[model samples]
Target: GRRIRKGAKMTYTTTYHSPLGIITLASDGEYLTGLWFNDQKYFGSTLTHNSIDKELPIFIQTKAWLDIYFNGEIPTFLPPLRYNTTVFREMVWNILLTIPYGTVITYKDIAQEIAKQTGQKSMSAQAIGGAVGHNPISLIIPCHRVVGTSGSLTGYAGGLNRKNELLQREKVNMTNLFVPSKKNL
Candidate 1:
């Protein structure tokens, strides 16, 4: 559900073999436009143009970032990213970047931050969840670090199993976090 810039017709894509699964990385020749698990929900949602299998400099940088990350270490650098989505989603994704490598935050926490930023009495946690679920750049933006209000591991677009794996990879304190029940999920 992202709007591609008019006349920006060409895009580039490359595949990353993550330990969990295959990930597809997309770029607009310079900035990273999207990264998603091959089988994940909303995969390639931001790539509305003709994408060729080309290796660009951004892809190389991103692969390095992911290389460090998949090695169970914090990546020392962030590859340049280009967001092609609504302003609200962009704001939510930026907040997600503030979540620490080995820590977790909740949808309610993000909503509160958005409220504080927008001068609103409150923002909807469900809305935040929606934005997080549709995040084009996944691991780098840290959408997998978000949990439910009750600390339940919920609503991961790349699958809850992958979310749990990522959190464990980061050595997060899993004592309190839990998978939600069927109805909750």
Candidate 2:
């Protein structure tokens, strides 16, 4: 599949302090490209060539979305996404939309949903995990809603603590929503 590129458009990067920690948000002229923790280990190996400015649309929209989300409101982000991935990744992201606000789903369930749509019962949950991790626009895409099969916090590129905070802030009952393989506290 062909990958979408941001091209020659200018990008802006900013760090916002949330309850989770410092989050780095990057945006092109039209939409948001990245949102992750500053100290996040998963993104440390990725190149940081994008510049930071305050004039991008994503910068404004991201800040607004963060405000609404932190205030215990369901954020409705419409930022343009530079999704660069395979057809499967795009399909996975589309399925992610069906997961409503303040709800959680396991990676296996996501894979099963995708399999139901595509009629491929052999799809692996690990592949779905890859798509979830590669999601560029975070909260809007709602990747945090994906958890472990045993209802554990599993691996979040944004960090498990941040993921827990997000789920908790959204008022998701962890005991009911997750299987409790491990506790943060």
Candidate 3:
């Protein structure tokens, strides 16, 4: 969930018609605060302050970026993304950014990367999962590119179907990407 300090910041929001569905883009007039699929997990977390306007410059830039992305062509660069979160989540998000356009990584792999980055003997994949799962910015940060230890298309806050679609759009080979037969309770 997101926390908003009284009179300290203003969150602006807008909707974009994405190939997957309507996506809500939130910003604090400069840096992007959050992006969420319609009805997705944590859809409006911390979105307490808001002014709905489609013409916000950030929204326009983000839409253009997404247009290029959904068309199967990577944008020349990512739009400005500004989010405030804990250090561990920030590290996980940075690692997610390095996942490449069409490649996927396991939670275990991310945990190992975090360990290497933080100089720890070991890290927990589940801890990495907690960070990745709560990523405020989804596609731009490439959280959908993470999978399970077995290459299974596992938990995605944006839903597994959307995750699969995004991967296919990015040209990830789904032949090796399977789903767990049993759902996690």
Candidate 4:
């Protein structure tokens, strides 16, 4: 176990060797705050304010969960998560948790769900994309499970290649899922 310091506060950190890439996990010594592919978009954005130690208990537990997950075994439960964000983003993350393992959902579908939950007439998929793209925690929260309405792999902060790798690992049927055309090829 690593000691924090004489007076410095504790910040937990650890790494997971995922099939897709190395993943960094961080916590406030309690709830997991972030998990991302080493170079994923918005990586570590949530824990930049604190110093880190790699031997925290939360980090150990998260690594264990990742171990089971990457072995193609469904994690019996989610690791503890804690984040500070807007209410809508929190709601989006909660909806993400409801997405079953090895299945995919569309951004439009998430938007519709949010709209239904909030009693709104409708919600914008673009708005949902913004929330999803900014998700600080990656795999544990299952952001990669979201796809585009036309079966396009729209956006994954961890890179599309890693997203595909994760889906394949989970045995998700990708028969119709395809990367979308950006401008040309």
Candidate 5:
């Protein structure tokens, strides 16, 4: 994950129309800083400065990436990204990037990976969930590929329905995955 520079100002934004909904993309002129569903929980939470509505090359590349994704194919390239998060969250988000298309991993799985990386005895799945939910870049980062243990679909900031749809579009098997009940949500 990359950090926003101290003197960086004037975040730029642009919107893309997607099957799930309107998505807002933010950039610091050269690198993508954020991508979120318009109505997502914690949408733009990482943005520290006001954004102006303008399209940058990064946004165009991202939209092209989304276009290919929505057409049911994985884009061979990745747009430049600058993650705005703490080190732990950045580590979690980096793991999210490794989840292949049409596959899923549990929060517990991520927690275990983090624990292994840090040489800790254990890591909290709930903490992993928090990091996953706060992911600044959505589809491209693949945060929707994360799930709970026991096949439960949980903690998607973009809404469970959108999460499910994104997975299905990637051709992920949904036979075992289920949206959790209200209490779990």
Candidate 6:
């Protein structure tokens, strides 16, 4: 298979009408590159010159997945993701796939899981948080499932309020969900 070139920048943006509001979907040629809430503040500067064919298969798949998700169905479609990030960030993103629908995990939990997988005890939660913050694909990667150490809502690139709404829409009752105080490493 021909891989999309690393650092070969491209972008396209479109608005999705959802219960939350108009979500702007951005993409590189090969993958979904961004999902932003209409009122999100930090996303303005993140826009770039990368332009892709909106009619590409990956873009179409992403739109279909979003349609299923918003229509009260579990999103079963997982499209290929093309992200430009560090090796560690890629590893962290792969780990995100193991988190099932309607479930949530804390940043600290992610750190411990990655540490166990790599046998690197020094890998900090802060580092994992950085990788998560850099997630280019949004709902498909389910970055909204991650929370703070206190089991409270944390900052989401898409906006914390949107994150809460996503969790709620998925029927994840954060109030009753168990968050361990001790790291699982």
RMSD of each: 3.7, 4.5, 3.9, 3.2, 3.0, 5.1
Tens digits of per-residue lDDT, candidate 6, 93-118, equal 88887789888988999999888988
Clashing pairs in 6: 10-50, 10-51, 11-50, 11-51
User: Highest lDDT among the candidates is held by which one?
Assistant: 1
Q: State in Å the error of residue 89, model 2.
A: 1.5
Worst 10 residues of 6 by lDDT: 176-185
Per-prediction TM-score, please? 0.94, 0.82, 0.92, 0.91, 0.94, 0.80
Native-referenced Cα lDDT, model 5: 0.91
Off by over 4 Å in 5: 1-8
Q: List the residue pairs that clash in candidate 1.
A: none
lDDT of 5 by residue, 1-185 (tens): 55677876878989999988999998888899889999999898756667788877899999999999999999999999997669999999999999999999999999999999999999999999999988889999999999988999888999999999999999999999999989866
Backbone collisions counted per model: 0, 2, 1, 0, 0, 4
Candidate 2's residue-wise lDDT over 1-185, tens digit each? 53557465456677777777777777655556677777664552222465654655567777888888878888766666665568998899888877888899889998888899898866799999988887766777888899987778877778777788889988888884543445552
lDDT of each: 0.92, 0.75, 0.87, 0.87, 0.91, 0.75
On the 0 to 100 scale, the lDDT of residue 69 in model 5 is 97
User: What is the TM-score of candidate 6?
Assistant: 0.80
Error of 1 at 61 (Å): 0.4
- Which stretches of candidate 1 lie above 4 Å from their native place? 1-6
On TM-score, the leading prediction is: 1
Q: Candidate 4: lDDT over CA atoms?
A: 0.87
The worst-scoring run of ten residues by lDDT in candidate 1 lies at 1-10
Tens-digit lDDT track for model 1 on 45-84?
A: 9786577999888999999999999998899889999987
How far does residue 34 in candidate 5 sit from its true spot (Å)?
0.7
